[model samples]
Target: MRLAMGFALITLFCSNSYADGYKLHPGTPTFQGKHFDIDIQEHCQEGEVTCPDVSYDSINKKTGARLHLKGRVMFNPNNYNFQGYIFDNGDYSYVLNPNHSKGTESVQIWNLNVFYKDKVIAFDEGIMQ
Candidate 1:
């Protein structure tokens, strides 16, 4: 019960941030995970805040296996749902969660548990964007 509440709070803080800061269109990350690091690149209309057609680039930190994927920026304004990016690439489903900090530094958190086909692939974090 306590853990659930804590997770809920964390989710609220992370997802509460607006997309105004993190504009994808060829977005890049300084660090990559052991398995891969996801990027929010291209497929956004000019002058639009949210995008439906989004592209993602991933590269394995160890083997350097780059995974190119495509997804969309989705959300439910009426229901206050996950306002982030998602990819449905067959067996590998990805939710590029918007985990940003709302402090003076004002950066995005890249804590990820990368999994491929129900197998633990790698872990990624320590990204400020």
Candidate 2:
């Protein structure tokens, strides 16, 4: 009985920790046949006040070139749900959950942007408008 209780406690703790991590799974979008795999994680570091880390990874399908992007993101105090990132590349930025008209519509669309060289490489969840 004691072992079972311990296991239950451990499970709860793990789930709680995971709940604090907000992740966005950007759908696969290829550029010039070079597939981009993105894994965006917004989680707090050991000494960070909140989830200030915004990072992503991309792998080239043809040449196997992997690009890892790291950025510092800020959270809005009035709206804790909104966050944005500016990557170390200096030309790239990603805004998460931007305020949009569609967001208030029935569909509840989520807006995510990927910029390169100050130009938007990819934007919006579905079709770009």
Relative to the unseen true structure, what is the C-alpha lDDT of residue 45 in candidate 2, on a scale of 0 to 100?
61
Off by over 4 Å in 1: 1-35, 47-50, 79-82, 100-104, 113-123
TM-score of each: 0.55, 0.41
lDDT tens digits, residue span 47-90, model 2: 45345466756444333456667766666677554454455566
Clashing residue pairs in candidate 2 are none
Listed per candidate, the RMSD to the true structure in angstroms reads 15.4, 16.0
Model 2 lDDT at residue 63: 39
Clash totals for all models, in order?
Answer: 1, 0
What's the CA error at residue 120 for candidate 1, in Å? 8.1
The clash number for model 1 is: 1
Candidate that would win on lDDT: 1
Q: Model 2: residues >4 Å from true position, as ranges? A: 1-36, 45-49, 59-66, 84-86, 98-100, 103-108, 116-129
